[model samples]
Target chain A: MSNKLLLMGDEAIAQGAIDGGLSGIYAYPGTPSTEIMEYVQNTKQTAELNIHRKWSANEKTAMEAALGMSYAGKRAMVCFKHVGLNVAADAFINASITGVNGGLIVVSADDPSMHSSQNEQDSRFYAKFAMVPILEPSNQQEAYDMAYFGFELSERLNVPVLLRITTRMAHSRAGVQRREGKPQNSLRLPSDPRQFVLLPSIARKNYRKLLMGQAAMEIESEKSSFNELISGNNKSLGIITTGIAYNYLVENYPDQKSPYPVLKICQYPIPRKQVEELYNSCNKVLVLEEGYPIVEEQLKGYLNTGKPVHGRLDGTVPRDGELNPNIVAKVLGMDVAEGQPIPDVVKNRPPSLCQGCGHRDVYEDLNEAMKVYGTGRVFSDIGCYTLGALPPFNAINSCVDMGASITMAKGAADAGLVPAVAVIGDSTFTHSGMTGLLDAINENSPITVIISDNSTTGMTGGQQSSATGKIVDICRGIGVDPNHIRVVTPLKKNHEENVRILKEELAYQGVSVIIPQRECIQTFARRKKSEKKESND
Target chain B: MKNDIILAGVGGQGILSIAAAIGLAAVNSNLYIKQSEVHGMSQRGGDVQSHLRISDKPIASDLIPEGKADMIISVEPMEGLRYLPFLSNSGWLVTNITPYMNIPDYPDINEILAKVKSLKHHIAIDADSIAKEAGSSRASNIVMLGAASLFLDIPFERIEEGIRQLFGKKGDEVVQMNLKALRLGREFSEKNR
Candidate 1:
């Protein structure tokens, strides 16, 4: 445990949580965030410490379950991607007002460059919106230290602390020193039971308390060693850096000395004292932050006394996508003398459906059936099958959120767009699509819900899907006609039959569910490999 | 003293296996290693590259700055070229002469090999055939690591030990197969380079 383990930022956070008295860590698998939970699940510590490490149906469930553990006075952590934060925002925002009985840290791994996400939304804004303190680590060691210290801050403030990280920080590996492990909290309920029950009367007072607590939170940020303004003799330009952006800035100066006075803000509620000193000491201020220019805008809005503040907003840095050291160098007026141009032979390689994938056959049939119905009528949800929206299939019209396909198709059907189709994967269906399907049944909308049952969450590395064996029953239970529910194995031989079935379903006057049942090819391969090993044994 | 390598391949082709082997060896040698990788949707048969930086001194950035990479070890031929921009002008390019034909517009296999052979600092090996000869088709990644090891500063014995440590859990036979694969690659590099 004392050894310096080379760990990804996500892995560091997981270890930090273990060392910080974590009783449970709940999450759904997601890009950039999946490794955090996977590390804990694979670790021997989960069993030794008796911590709860289980996948939830969705991010909201994970958030609420973590809050439930906090309500029992046990430190709990929840990790998810930035988009997953949107899914869990309801519970996340409400948890702030209710506050925590035990330490709780919500780790939202943001994809600033939209590397694997639909958008590049920052989670620090969520922290600000929820009126909670945020810890943004600039390196793997600090990522561990922040997780361990974040729990104490969460407990002391009686609120959930937000641990925000971006893709580079989440995926990049570096050596991290370990901290001493702590014991899990003994189960103890909140002193005031109604503190969580947000009845308007109680909620109003709690809301006021949260508002009145901002000053104290700001004072904590002011006193925090994590928020520091380092001294420099050259005061021509002041640099403000936060999160992984600090690494990019520091990387420009290999000697680790930026002649400019710098304020490195890792723990935030916007340390006004550091900002004041930085602004006063330098001629101009340059802000470096990943994602949206929230910090830059905040400084300009609240503290700007006519001194020029330059960042993403004013074009000091690119407005969109993640920040890199090269861009950082360019902004700092440092020369980047290296790097050759990519040759033309190296063509773009966009992600495609794997060969022999079940979704491939399904999309083929769906595209054939929909060709008669025409394009722009199919609404798909997020998953591997969202790849159908690409290439020769070009099968789906929209893929906005987890379950938006069914609901969006339903709305379109209601608008008299007959034969509207919704294609959603099994895991995504269970995540948020089931409720939309039920609503479609209630209205008897003329929409065909094609639930591609892959028997696992294929997109996020084949986790056990919530809808493994229950898709048909769930549809029937949702009040869809049992006769209209059809299940088919997605294979090339079944293409003609599957297309016929899809055509019939699209022609249906009421709610219909077409269940294309097949195990994901990747999962099948893994199972076959393991079974081969087992048989050899 | 240092090795800045870009491990390139299509997702699901197991470039990470090579990274894992090299990482284990680097750690065993007490060298600082920082590796940055691609995850998520790209795993659905897309182009992927991992930046692996190992040095005797402390490492700073996770990414290998362009034109600073000491070597390019690719499991796919075109994937090796895909990272050409990152490779230093004099860096070694060790690539498998196999084509992962997920894309319809994939350049001709011969064309890829021709370009690779055209380079003064290139070692082209049919790792798949070499791995199969070594007794396991999946050992191609190990063969890649073997080919790459010729350019690395770390000891070959440590990498062989790394293979044992990494694949020993799978079974002794599998570990032995990979060790054989690794040796085949080193022998190939010695003959060809």
Candidate 2:
């Protein structure tokens, strides 16, 4: 069992967290980051240890819960995708002021190429803004090793550690070696009384302490094993790689040797001294990073020393999209082999809502009902229902961030767009939509909010939704008129009746909610399959 | 002792099982392997591709560069053609002839098959029928994998063992069905070539 195991970077991080004495893990399901929690949940060790592995309602709640576990003197890890970090930014930014008694690791899986994400926002900026130590692994082994030692680093520095990974690192599978396990920490309060309290007098003092602690954090980064300086034979061009970009750089070199002085900066605060070494040793500098040119931008400071700094900011590298070995080779001025282009016979195959999905039925019925009102009035949240923006359905208008549907619809309704509809998933409703629903109800906004209840988080592979079987109670609790809150089964046979219900909700002057409740088709099939297998056994 | 493979197919087409089988065999042979997969939104019936690399030497990038793939192995016909840009000039294109028409604008099956046949090194297999003969239509992905196995440098018996190890949890009957499916697919490819 101690031998090398084939694991995805996310799985490796989960194993490392478990082996490194994790007492709790919290996360809201999002792509690239979802597998980290799913792996921990599926593992036998976490279950045996009775570790807290339940999904949180949203990323902010997840972040706070993890901080709470850390407050009780136990190692905790909070994971989410790049956008989820935006949701958790409030707690994440303040955690640095109120240092921790136990280790805390915040894992942010970024999507640089907009792969399964709306925007290519970098999570490193969030870490930097919070003034926390960052760990960006270059490979699967480092991903595991960082998680293994990251807790100690966090505890030693008395601050939360940020483990930032991109989509490639999160989803790629490689062999990872295991490390010796550490025992879980016992529950104990922080030695400093009033540390968690953020009163202005104490908060001002804590903020100063955090500012003073930056030097120590940078020193730890300077000495981190993940940060290495490799001296090369040539000095014409010095290359700096952060995270998985290091792999793409070394991939062009089969001998695993680059001609220029290379500073592999996985641990951050830029590891100032090593960067200075590389900057001084070579004539020109090239910074390769997966997402934004964070390091590159820093190197080319306000008053440049006139040393050439080439990266995404300049035309040296493509400003957008993810980096690949071919891109690296091209930038290195190497001849890359051009393959045959795909024939015209192959067409675009964008992701679509699965056939027989409840979202599809909801979209069909809603589209039919919206024919009179016309399109561009249905505001949708993030989920499978977002695909309704595509052809065949052409139902929804906007697919902004989660919970934006109801709030945006309310705003639009406030702007004289009457009966603006909001299409949201059940899981999303609990995540952040409930509060918006409350706002709409209090204002009596004339918006038809469609809570397309799928009973599970369908987009990120059917995680247990926080709002399963509770939509009706939630709506009632939000003060929506019970009569205006209607439930309809979204099926082809019930399409006519479902359309009628939607139309009625749309016509209402006050706030109205339509719940199209059905289990996800994929999850339903899986449940039926397992049930059949059980009966057979 | 290196093979760069691109596994392409529509989501829910079971290409991951094909990847699992190949990955197990590669790991069993003590080779270094890296597989990059598409997850989340792409799994709900979208075009998905996995870049799989196995080598005697340590692999660096999880992704394979364009025009360097040793083979384009697909469980669906058009899916195979979609990755032709990644396939090497001498590389083989092994694909199932069956069409997965989930999209509304899917091209004609005959034209897709004709394009596949135009390639110098290709194996267009009726793996659906072959899998049906082997006792389960669900094993079509395995059949496609079996056809692609001929060009793979790994030993054939190791692939059989891989299927056993991968599906061992499902019971012996399922494994046996897949083994038969693999064999039928291999025999068809051998005769056709």
Candidate 3:
């Protein structure tokens, strides 16, 4: 055995992919999941592994590249954050219909509680919708093992696998069992060219095959060793836990002795036979799963024994809010120690943009402009800058998703709203906002779209956005008047100038785009440190 | 026996390293251990925390419930106080006395310190100063962890071995400096006790 090493969950996934004989990894940088690709790219030892790694233009492109590689009879992996999945939804859903020729794994790292994300969306539901298998790992080791196994399972089932990890699982470092690398799979062109061709008739036939394949898929899940039954003598209660929820259930029942059978499922869709057997064995089956009641709902339908399945559906577990051990214990009728009362150590600490953050200056100027116009006139997109909706800088009115700001502002303008402003990050504007800008230009909507160009994807880790140096050019290409597209630094030093420029844009009649150019504080700090080293040398 | 520990600090404060060290120690002791951590916003100086569960049997959860943690180790005083809800009434809190001001608005730093001092079962150490004395401020996390190690069943030798395994390749000087800081922290904690 090799010496033990501390590896982050993302790094472990990368290592697992290499060990699983990955031929290629295609991805775009996003928080929590960015390191997976970065690690593979930077590791000197990986050169001998014959891995083809590329940073795709966006999540959709990244996914399609991996699909193409998989179709060539090579194992491939693609990764992106939760919201990036939305950009890749079209490719992801279609791949389900056109089965895989080789191992293919899609790694989606979801940001819950809106930590560095547009919304706290769980990506497991996406897997469910696509009718594909999903694997959620609780810790670093499982993350590594599941990533490797997920690819194997993908090829076995002739389908792509969704390996959903969360913020907690992506970044956390733990001891992973290191394995020797495997030889890269040789590239073999698709034997059946018709499988790659997707006409309406062929697509319809493939879609039916996908539906018919579900029965065997369920049977495969039942026989899989990942789904196990942990039992006690208690027949009055049974708990069905999946992914991280299984971890919570174990922690909650540490000291309690209950007559219940616990079904721990790390893989999905959960085995219907296991749920049916669990229902037959217990009076009530309590479903414990994070994100949504995917397993619980299926159990409710599969268990014909008339046994009550309690979970988020029946309000046993709160429908909203993240679940922890205490919440699980409370539901399980277990006694948890009472925590010491907080002695009002400090007031509630609401998250805010960092001091000297470009977002701060941008919001300050935006707020001033809003005061000049009217409140509730600005539409915001997702990013670290979206915190402008909070107190001390109540600048933005609505924030739906990544590129919704531009569309929302255009919609408002079409509805006869005056001085409509759209606030979006430079990275987000490139991700999906460009299309919205095209629509705005086509309709000649009288709205101002403010692209907060921090030169990085600030909401997630500071990764390079695709439109870093090309915001002005992109806007010009999209038909926004070059003269109307103004750029300014959003800083305390440039506060007056930024506000003046914003005011001018708001007053302009046609579709105007404001490019606020500044660097994120974290990236700026890193740059300063590197420059200092260079200077010292 | 099951031992659950929670480590809290600002992002980039080496909270995960402490958990890794503890996890490594457990692995060395031939115990089953499970640990989990928060990722996003962790690099942005946000409140980052980790749970390390060590048991003779398999660990069920990667998270420890409020008041169930036997020990709460923190790299920052404010972070320690922020996670007070997770500490058992009888649990011990070993943390650095240094305060980290979070982004957005926060209460007076002194007020936060006062509240932490008033809380029972707390031990405050100038871990940052110790680490600085050892020639690097980043080692403060290791120092705080060394202070907290006095309460855990895991032996200091195991911790040292884990540290060696983690950072042994960084060079002898770096390893020796951290070892010195850890020893100094242990001595200070023993003197305080």
Candidate achieving higher lDDT, 2 or 3: 2
Question: Which 10 consecutive residues of model 1 chain A have the lowest summed lDDT?
Answer: A337-346
What lDDT tens digits, residue by residue, belong to model 1 across residues A1-537? 215898999999999999989999999988899999889999996898889998999999999999999999999999999999999999999999999998999999999878788999999999999999999988899999999888889988888999999998899888899988988889999999898999999989999989998888899999998888888889999999998777777766756667889899998899988899899999999999988999999989875667999999989899999887778889988777564566567778899998889999999998888887677999998999999988978888898999999999999999999989899999999999989988898889999999999898888798888888998888889899998999998999999999999899888899999999988889999999999989999
lDDT per residue (tens digit) for residues A1-537 in model 2: 115799999999999999999999999999989999999999998889989999999999999999999999999999999999999999999999898878999999999888899999999998889899999999898999999898999999888999999999999999999999999999999998799999999989998988999999889889988999999989999999999888888888867788878999999898999998988889999988899988999999877666999999997999999999999999999888767898999998999999888888988898899899887899999999999999888888899898999999999999999879999999999999999999999999999999999899999999999999899998999899999989989989999999988888899999999998889999999999999999999
Docking class of 2: medium
The global Cα lDDT (0 to 1) of model 3 is: 0.81
Best by DockQ: 2
Task: Please give the range of 10 consecutive residues that has the lowest summed lDDT in model 3 chain B.
Answer: B37-46
When summed lDDT is taken over every stretch of 10 residues in candidate 2 chain A, the lowest stretch is: A1-10
> What does the lDDT read for residue A436 in candidate 1?
94
| Per-residue lDDT of candidate 3, residues A350-454 (tens digit) | 456777788888888888877867799989987777778877888889978768999999999999997799999988888789999999999888899888888
The order by descending lDDT is: 2, 1, 3
Root-mean-square deviation of each candidate, in angstroms? 1.8, 1.2, 3.1
- Note the residue pairs that clash in candidate 1: none
Error of 3 at A13 (Å): 2.7
User: Roughly what TM-score does model 2 have, to 2 decimal places?
Assistant: 0.99
Using Cα atoms, each model's DockQ against the true complex is: 0.58, 0.71, 0.46
Write one digit per residue (lDDT tens) for candidate 2, span B1-193: 8899999999988788888899999989888899999998888899999999998888888998888899999988999999988888999899989888988899999999999999999999999999999999999989988898898989999999999999899999999999999989888889886
* Residue pairs with clashing backbones, model 3: A234-A259, A234-A260, A247-B61
